[model samples]
Target: MSDRICCPLCRCAEVLLSKAYPEQAEVLALLREHGPMTASEIRAKVDKSIGVTAINNRLERLRAFELVARTRYGNGWKYIAKPEVES
Candidate 1:
């Protein structure tokens, strides 16, 4: 059943981030490549024209799955990917 799916976007959310949402997935890939970085840093590093607020919002959404982590940096937060957990 659809309800059995771990993610509505991907039946196998564990392995299919890119397929679930390519644009949003880019945020994840970017963090993986850059390590910990502020939302503004992430926005600048990405290829698209998204706003910093949007990047911050995406980071929050990604946090729902523990796909991302955050640490206080200066007066704001830096987002980073959680260590990949293999099954």
Candidate 2:
């Protein structure tokens, strides 16, 4: 059986995003609240338990989900949360 929960009234994408990993949600919130930020910057602001590599992983996953986007920034990359989709 699938591990994800489904709601008949919700959009598929919205349901998937709602079920995203906690770390991914954190990363998204940081970008939305603080504007674009590098992985290193996110690492510094995220929970101490979340490491640099984990931060990078979450960023990439969020990107794949189209919930976030990245751009070249200095020598590294900066990520920002995509604008929320209207219901």
Candidate 3:
């Protein structure tokens, strides 16, 4: 993956990703830094208030934006951050 992860929404200064979707950004950063990981693993490292379901929800939304992708791993799924999309 070349260690370069990027998302239009993440790069957009207008939206201020940290302020707008802190949880989502944190999730993305985790995946980018740690390589592929299951949703449960993400839930474990994220804020105590964020649950597995919420992590899954964030993964789904990230998938919709092409910022991250998930692959079947055993009985669960592992997510990987996608490279930057050229505008």
lDDT pick, better of 2 and 3: 3
Candidate 1 least-lDDT 10 residues: 1-10
Model 3 misplacement above 4 A = 1-10, 13-15
lDDT of 2 by residue, 34-79 (tens): 8899999999997888788989999999998897899999888999
Measured with C-alpha atoms, the lDDT of residue 64 in candidate 2 is: 89
Among residues 3 or more apart in sequence or in different chains, the pairs in candidate 1 whose N, CA or C atoms overlap within 3 Å are none
Candidate 2 local distance difference test against the native? 0.76
lDDT of 2 at 76: 87
Question: Model 2: how far is 44 from its true place, Å?
Answer: 1.0
Pitting candidate 1 against candidate 3, the one with the higher lDDT is 3
For residues 1-87, write the lDDT of model 1, one tens digit per residue.
Answer: 122233444446634766666756788878877789898888788756788888888899899877888999999998887765433
Candidate lDDT scores, in order, read: 0.75, 0.76, 0.78
lDDT of 3 by residue, 16-37 (tens): 6556777777888898888899
Candidate 2 versus the native: TM-score?
0.74
Q: Name the candidate that leads on TM-score.
A: 3
Each model's number of backbone clashes? Answer: 0, 0, 0
